[model samples]
Target chain A: MAVDKKFVGKTWPTMVYEVGKEKVKEFAKAIKSNNPYYLNDEFASQSKYKTIVAPPTFAVVFGAKLIEPIFMDKELNLNVAMLVHGEQEFEFYTMVKAGDILYSNTRIIGIEHKEKLDVVAIEIMTKNQYNQDVSKGIYTFVVRK
Target chain B: MKAMYEKNSIDAGDTFNAQQKIDKYRAIYYAGASGDFNPIHIDAEFGKMVGLGGAILQGLCTLGFTADAVTTWIGDPGRLKKIKCRFSLPVKIGDTITIEGLVTEVHEDTGTVVIKVINQNGGDVLTNVQAEVVTK
Candidate 1:
């Protein structure tokens, strides 16, 4: 099924995600990042940030979760098996830390059809529970027929 | 240079190193775990056909790694408020990605930190990256 171009500007309802310390460490270990700043509070305190900081890419996990419901909608007819991540861009408003409750609102930015493929772009604007914008990410996915 | 601290906390930029390597198997694992089966990431022939020298790592995988970098720095994954990045180049196998970050801004009122990443090869940048995290 072809994706509807009219849905390009649709914004999904906001979803909330909670940050966890263990999960962050697991992700860091999986990626083999041994940066002491992520592991030792003492070392982090010596740096300019003072508090422990998260790695830059950690948003994918939470952001992706927020977008999952949209793709699962039956009306979309998205072929999950034939989907490929084409590109991703993140614009940051602030650094993320553990214990913050994140709220994300996703929107479909663009849709283009190329022969047998449908290219869809989704933009997610995430904020803390306090309602301050923290980051915005644009992700492109290609769905092949 | 005097070391700067943020409210007795470490800044994300100060914890990152200028050198790191992305292993081939790690790329494969990321592809599997993330369900991103791009041919250019798993098939050398397909990669070459598409103009890449060989199988390249998925851009999302690198992004995921960057997320890991942020979570590790904060000491708790739960404190993450947001993260954002951009991909400038294809990361091939054996490419040593030197992740670096610079604190562009720190908001004390909101407790947010902004940073960027660069893939370095012999001191030359391969990719340009940026992200932000809100601390606890």
Candidate 2:
């Protein structure tokens, strides 16, 4: 079944994620990144940010929480077995640092049904504890029929 | 060294590259860190049953590698303002991924880089990759 177009404007509940220093390091190591801004505390402290900043792709960590719920949504009934991430796009307004609390809100931005598959795009906007915009991620998934 | 894009010296056709080895434990570590516990990425038998041959690496992890290449070239995490990619192929555990960024356009305040992520077999894993960074 194709994903219903009515859910195109649907929204999900807000989720809050606390960035951890160790997790930031773990993510960097997982990606095999040796950048000091994410790993070396001394190097990061002396830098302009004066703190260890999470990598650009770290947005996905928090963004995933919002994304998962959409897949599990009974109304949407996403076919998990046939779904694959088609593409991803992110626009960062500011870099997030360790210990910062981020609030994420996701909504369905676009839904299209092609001949063999259906594509759904979710836009997630993350904000800092101070209400400053951190990053915007557009996650697109293709569900094959 | 500061991770600032040298606006004056860099122009279209400038390039930077980085290579990462996807070790055996890569998928496990990435699954734990990213909270993506999909069986297709963690279970070899399940992957084979699903026709993926064996457990495949997470697409997001590959994207992470691509982002690492970009930030490594710029030398600062904050300098990267935007990045996107299409997951074109399945990256296995032993594959060596290489990311190459070509400066396609440069303006007063920003530069656009066209990135290509390829595997050890010269397969394009992430195609149509583009990144926008702050140069000013």
Candidate 3:
């Protein structure tokens, strides 16, 4: 099945994700990162951030949540099993903290079909509940046929 | 925010080292967080059947560790703008992966930095990451 090119510009519904301290620590531990900046508030406060900070890739989990609707759409002809994370990129406008309430909106930026692969790109823009843009990510997935 | 970059800057080919003994508990925790419970990453028997001698860690988990490396080196947590990478190989349980990164490029206008990571044993290029961070 071919993916709909018309869906390239389609935008998914917004998702609200609450950043938590435990989640940050879990992600840090999972990666075996002993960075005090991510684990200890006291150490973090000593730094310029003045608070605990999240790892760069912490956005991957939340980014996925914001774009869940697109992958869940059957009409996209996307097979979850055959999908592989091809590449991901994030652009940060501001720093994110544990207590921040993040609101994210995702849009499909590009789609291309080759003989045996479907390349799809999704862009997620995340902002704090205060409506300040924090980061924007462009994720590309390769769906094997 | 105070500027930390003024005091330290990581150059390309600069190495960062750390270790992890992939224990059973950590494996389970990763499975829960990543929602990736592939048998090879959890069940040793299943891992052997797939040609791996024992359970292996998820690629994302390794990538997460790489992200931690960046945060530690930069001395800031929330300032990471981007982290992008491609998984080139698999990491098995009990294997202590030493994550290392080099500053490949820096965009002065954008304050973006590019960093690349390689597993210590040279087993796999775990992550090829580019980030736009706020530097001093």
Candidate 4:
């Protein structure tokens, strides 16, 4: 069944994630990066952020909090078995640093039904403890019908 | 951001490239880090059963690779103002991704970079790749 278009603009509750230094290193290494900004704290301390930072795509880590509930949302009733990531976009306003308290919110921005697949786009907006916009990600998923 | 940009001289027509070999266990590592343990990415048998031929790397991980390439060149992770891409093809474990970037345009504070990411097979794994970086 296609996800109901009525669910467009639907939103979930905010999620809070405390960026961890080790987790950031794990994510950076997973992506095969040894960038001093992410892995070398002494190097990062002298840089603009003044602390170890995460790669911009780290938005997905915190953003995943929003995705899980959406995938399990009874009303959405998405066919998780058939779904795949189709597209992604991220706009970074501030770099995420270790120890930052991130507050993230998610909303359904789009839904389209075709003959054989359904496309859903969700927007996740995140802010740091200072309420500075850290990043905004548009995650698009395609489900084969 | 300004202090970081002071060290690099970015101009239009500048180009750079980077590559990452998607080792067999790369996806598993990514799954642990990103919490995207969808079966098709971790189980080759399940992937084949699903008609994917084999377990595939997460699209976000591929994007992460590209982001790494761009940021490494720009010299500051924080200056990457925006990036967007369409996942045109599945990147399998053991596939090496080659990222090439061209600085097509530049202004006083930001530059527009067009990125092309291809796999070892010469397939366009990521299309419509573009990123914006702040210079000052």
Candidate 5:
């Protein structure tokens, strides 16, 4: 079945994620990034953020939470078996620091139905504890027909 | 925001390069951290069953590596304001990818650098990758 175009404007409930210092370090190491801004607390404390800041791509960690619901959404009835990540775009605004509580909301922004596949794009917007916009991500998935 | 480049140091046509090795267990660690438990990334048999040959690295992990390339060049993670990329090929374990970026445009008024990431393999792995950073 093709992805329903009606779901294009649908949105998921807001989810909250609390950034952890160790988690940031773990993520940095996983990506082979030894940057002190994301790893060494001592170095980060003296840096501008004054605390360990997550690497820029760490936005995916929080963004994934909202994305999971979309994949699991029964109404959408997505064919997970035929889906693959097609592209990703991220815009970082404020630095995401350790211990910052982030609120994420996802909405279906685009749906392109092709003869052989369907491309679904979900836009996720995250804000910090102060309600300052932290990051925005557009996750595009290609679902084969 | 602090400046990543000198007032007159940056201009269009500047370039930088970075490379990363995809370790054997990179996918497992990434799955643990990112909560992406996709079998195609962690389960070798599952991947082969699905025609992937073997377990493949997560696309986001590869993107993370690309992001590292940009941040390392700029010398600050905070200065990296935006990044986008299209996953053109599957990144298998032990594949060494080199990320090269060229400064295509420099906004003098905003003090931002626009960069395009290209694969050294004739654009086989990652394509249409680009990033923007605030020099200020």
Candidate 6:
């Protein structure tokens, strides 16, 4: 069955995630990155950003928090077992630093039913405590029947 | 050391390669870091039950590697302006992913890099991988 096209514009409560310095370091380590911008405090303190900053793909860490609600929503009824990530995109604006409170909003942007699979897309827009755009991520998934 | 792009002058044909040996615990650590605890990524039995063979690595984790290759080469994380890719294969434990990046185009003030991500078997793991950075 095809995902309801009517859910295209459906949205959930906006999620607020606080970027933590240690959490950033943990994520950096998981990706096997030892970038000073993400780890070294004194080195990053001397850099242009003036402090530890999250990696470019760190957007996914915050973005993942919002994705869970969508995947678990009974109304959407996503086939969790058969769904696989199809594609991902990220456009970085202002780098996210520790101690920044980010507000993220995600919505169902598209739901297309193809011959072999159903493709669902959700776009997430995030901004910081300063209301500056942090980054935008579009996560696409393929649900095989 | 981190601002090498500003020093090296990134141009067309410039290339760099980064390799990662995906350890068995990669997914568990990734799940803790990224909040993706899907069974297909962490539970081997569940993953096999679902026909994934065994616990597979998260697609985002693989993309993280792809982005890291570019930022590592460019030397400035903020200089990486854009990145996108499609997950073409399931990366499992013990797989070695090789990320090869080529500066395919350089415009007046920006450089475009085309990336090829492949597993040890030479199978495409992620396709259409690309990133763009500020050059000016």
The models' CA-based lDDT, in order, is 0.65, 0.89, 0.70, 0.91, 0.84, 0.90
What TM-score does candidate 6 get on C-alpha atoms?
Answer: 0.96
Sorted by lDDT, highest first, which candidate order results?
Answer: 4, 6, 2, 5, 3, 1
* Superposed model 2: Cα runs more than 4 Å off: B1-9
lDDT (10s digit) by residue, model 2, range A60-135: 7888778888889999999988999999999999789999999998999999999999999999999999999999
What ranking of all candidate models by DockQ puts the best one first? 6, 2, 4, 5, 3, 1
Which tens-of-lDDT digit does each residue in B16-55 have in candidate 1?
Answer: 5444477767666665444445678888888888778889
Q: What are the per-residue Cα lDDT tens digits for candidate 2 across B68-113?
A: 8878877777878999999999998788989889989999878899
Per-residue alpha-carbon lDDT of candidate 4 for residues B1-136, written as tens digits (9 for 90 to 100): 3354343667889898999999999999999999988899999999999899999999999999999898888777877899999999999988988999998999988889999999998999999999998855
* Winning model by lDDT: 4
User: For candidate 2, what is the TM-score?
Assistant: 0.96
Docking class of 1: incorrect
The candidates' DockQ values read 0.19, 0.79, 0.50, 0.66, 0.62, 0.79
Off by over 4 Å in 4: B1-7
Q: Report chain B TM per candidate.
A: 0.75, 0.90, 0.74, 0.93, 0.83, 0.94
**Clash list (residue pairs), candidate 2:** none
lDDT of 3 by residue, B1-136 (tens): 3453332554444445555555666666777665566677789888788676888777677767766666766665554556777766667766766665555555562344555554557665555665555444
Give the poorly placed runs of model 1, Cα more than 4 Å off. Answer: A45-50, B1-58, B64-136
Share of native interface contacts recovered by each model:
0.25, 0.85, 0.63, 0.86, 0.82, 0.79
Query: On a 0 to 1 DockQ scale, where is model 3?
Result: 0.50
Provide the lDDT at B30 for model 4: 96
